[model samples]
Target: MAFLIRKDFPLRGFATCGDCGSNLRSSWSKGKTKYYPYYLCQSKGCDSYGKSIPRDKIEGAFADVVKTLEPSPNTWCGLKPCSDVHGMRDWLKPKILRV
Candidate 1:
């Protein structure tokens, strides 16, 4: 009752409530014979306040939302240079222009 078996909060800062706009809080809860993870809104007076949503439900929805998100070509271009091998190549290549 005072401690949790699972204490990780993967969505704490990223997931917010639709009604309250407050960041969702996660916690481990006692359920019959097992401890279950949950996401909830702790903002007072909000419609979702104190309502415990299962971790799987929220994370599944989060995964689905991001499933269709593809980085643009520009993103790859920008990140390519940030990668170690590419960065070294760019840095080591000749910068002088031949006349």
Candidate 2:
């Protein structure tokens, strides 16, 4: 299949090439009947240079990994029930964050 290209890339700066350590560039590739989003390594000599990873695959994995992260316990000052905007304000107003 041949691809038609566009320049915008949501993961442009944050994602990198796994084989060459160059950044992964992204674009919308036109498929036989549709447009597909792909992330690819564009470094000149890399073994994985032209291979394309579907955008949903990479971004979905990224989101999954992000879901596993948590703020450090020491950095959490407090949590109060968010019943309303005023309640939220009340919760935040008195606490001096721990870290």
Distance from true position, residue 24, model 2, in Å?
Answer: 0.6
Candidate 1 residue-wise lDDT at 31: 80
Residue-level lDDT tens digits of model 2 in 17-96: 66776667787899899999888888888898889988887777667766776768864566544556455544433332
- Residue 10's C-alpha lDDT in candidate 2? 46
Error of 2 at 4 (Å): 20
Please provide, for model 1 over 1-59, each residue's C-alpha lDDT reduced to its tens digit, 9 standing for 90 to 100: 12222337655555678788776778899989999998889999999899988888887
| All models, RMSD in angstroms | 14.2, 12.5
Candidate 2: Cα lDDT at 70: 79
What does the lDDT come to for candidate 1?
0.66
> Which residue pairs come into collision in candidate 1?
none
TM-score winner? 1
